[model samples]
Target: MRIVEDLRAELGDRIVTEPQVLQAMRTDRSGWVGPGTPAVLVRAASVADVQAVMRLASVHRVPVVPRGAGTGLAGGAIGTEGAIVLDLSGMRRVLEVDVQNEVAVVEPGIVTDDLAAVLAEHELWWPPDPASRAISTVGGNIATNAGGLLCAKYGVTRESVLGLRVVLADGTLIGVGRRTVKGVAGYDLTALMVGSEGTLGVVVEATLKLRRISRDPVVTIGATFPDVIAAAAAAAAITASGLRPAALELMDAATCTAIDDLLQPSAEYPVLAGRGAFLLVRTDSAAAADEAALAARLIRHAGGEPEVSTDALTGERLMQVRRSAHPAYARLGEVLIEDVAVPRSALPAMFAATERIGASHGIPIPTIAHAGDGNLHPNLVVPPHLAGEPGHIPDVVWSAADELFHEAIALGGTLTGEHGVGILKRRWLADELGGDVFALSERLKAAFDPLNILNPGKVL
Candidate 1:
């Protein structure tokens, strides 16, 4: 199409059409989805540039995939055939920080942790911190309503957003929500777009509500269990106890071993004992006595052995271990990550079911979880060679994943908790939303994007 020529002339070197460059942008953190080459990528530096790209795509009836840092796990950023990649990584600006009002206005490309750091200077914070916060963009977080360690207490990214600047499929720019804390404005379109996964509109800017930054010392607790069921039981008990922690994470034996090898190659299990599956608990407290007592009591009640660390630096370092749990497994082999969630009450059963599925498939499925939120990521590692081989391994991996996801649905849960139904989970969406409900969703998609050009093949 000559439109590529137009974009290249208008965007100069900012537009990339080379095969290698386009190929590089085709995958994400997990690298498990589309390998479709985009016709071109427009590296938008300003709102006007984004508008230009959108205007062209709208007129040409070309699909445009809004992209941020491309850190999505569910292939939300992957492009389809002959599409335009509206790259926003160049618009990384913090527009406004209203400390008194507890809000910040930022462009789509602002990195999550960087925004958090900027807010921290003014004594404010954004709590939805995905593990990739260091690299993921605000736009990606908004698209997925991304959740993380603090979601159990502070909620997800959607809760922090007060407003959005979205570009419609027809190239119209509309602002939704407000800077003020409360507004009954039109329909609640702001919330609708928050987790739309780029299916409805392309988010350009957002007004985010922040909380007062805390200097309260962190308290760390570690509890070890014999198996995943016991580990899940401890997690449930902790939640039932009514104590809100800054972070609650679970790691299985394989992941723990991987982490131990990287951090302390010479140390044995005694150094990092409580090994089968463990929970890392964190809290903000000023006194050691209270945090210590709470940890000890909960661990004993849940049939666990407790290890507590109240030193600030030490506690932070321990949390790093929890944050790196998934990546640690990636070092071992090719991974198919599963973000399966279930009702809090079904956590033990879910954990038991996962173990059973893994054994039945003969695949070593290691797990990590934001347990307090009932979100588990059970990763099935495949040696690249084995994945390519024709055998029960690939069949087994897919079967185990299907069983786990179906079980989550049967237990009154959704297919995914944080990751959107990007191409991977599209078929099962009807199973969760029902036929009529999913039909209505498709109608809504048609209503907003009649041409169906916005992130085609994503989320119905």
Candidate 2:
């Protein structure tokens, strides 16, 4: 209560204590509610506002949850009980675009797609295009080190982010990283903060590296296999063949069915017609045509039906089917979206393992993958009765997720590929990182946040 009073006094009308607003900030798209309601929400409009919030929060010893567009799939941005929800969505601004230097300086709250649009005007591109780019903010993407269909070739948010201006727990402002393409001056704190999920500090501004938009025509190849394993194998083969596609996506049979059901009566794009599994590959390099032709031939060799097209509309339509996977699953019930990554060569085995896990659990785990990078998004469909119940995840679903996480680790992969270890996956982080590394990480956290006032109960 005193902290709330202090925040209101310091921030004037910017601080919100309304019950409805607090309730809305309690959780994110992950649907996992925080333990308690946030004491206040501070809509930070600028870096100064962010600094003020962190400074007061440090003095009051209040937990500060830094939030962006709230499009995060993990519970990283969820507002916990008695904490100060520092909302940065209002700070959306593209400060500078250095086309000659191929870099952009932007405020954290700028939408990812909006930044892309601005960059597009200059024939420049930001490669980290998450599925939620339309709504997700650049800050959130940097916080999660997000990856997308293009990650296999272009890399994730960490790769695009060259530098950051962050506000620490004690209200200290610091900048990390370099503007140039190559610099190893000091510790890679910028890289660390990219996926730190706001635990290390609050990112207020970022300098992002940019790439030239490929002018070559895109060639898309759509293929259907007898089953998910075969399709995954084909994807692996494509990667092994050393053909780098701009995007390589895979959807399991259930995912295809769900997409088709969601987009019903669309005669143009029937998602495999209840076939087995689907793969969408797009190449946009100078040799896109040749690469796509070779990829199509490989798909055919792998017992798949291949469809090749050079039309941009057709490519987008095909990619749309892949993008619709999450929404389609959401239509079924409350979904526990799982993210895992494994070695490219082990993709088929991982798919087989997922199938086995789903069958053993007796639940439908419709999966989609950025196949080129071996990152799989398995949607665990919760029963309809439990749908929309805040803070609820069935025991069975957690059990299945536990098994899936272990399987990924066993296969020499990670519990999360793009998504950070928010509250959802923090339980198993130590298991993957091992005790020594995990302890070191804890020390680092303590060094950055001695009082533990920043994003408490997250990513330790």
Best TM-score among the predictions, by candidate number: 2
lDDT of 1 by residue, 117-153 (tens): 8888898998888988889999999999999888987
lDDT of each: 0.82, 0.90
Candidate 1 segments whose C-alpha is farther than 4 A from its true place: 33-35, 265-274, 285-292, 383-385, 389-393
lDDT of 2 at 96: 95
Clashes, model 1: 0
Total backbone collisions, model 2: 0
TM-score of 2: 0.98
lDDT agreement of model 2 with the native: 0.90
Q: lDDT of model 1 at residue 337? A: 78
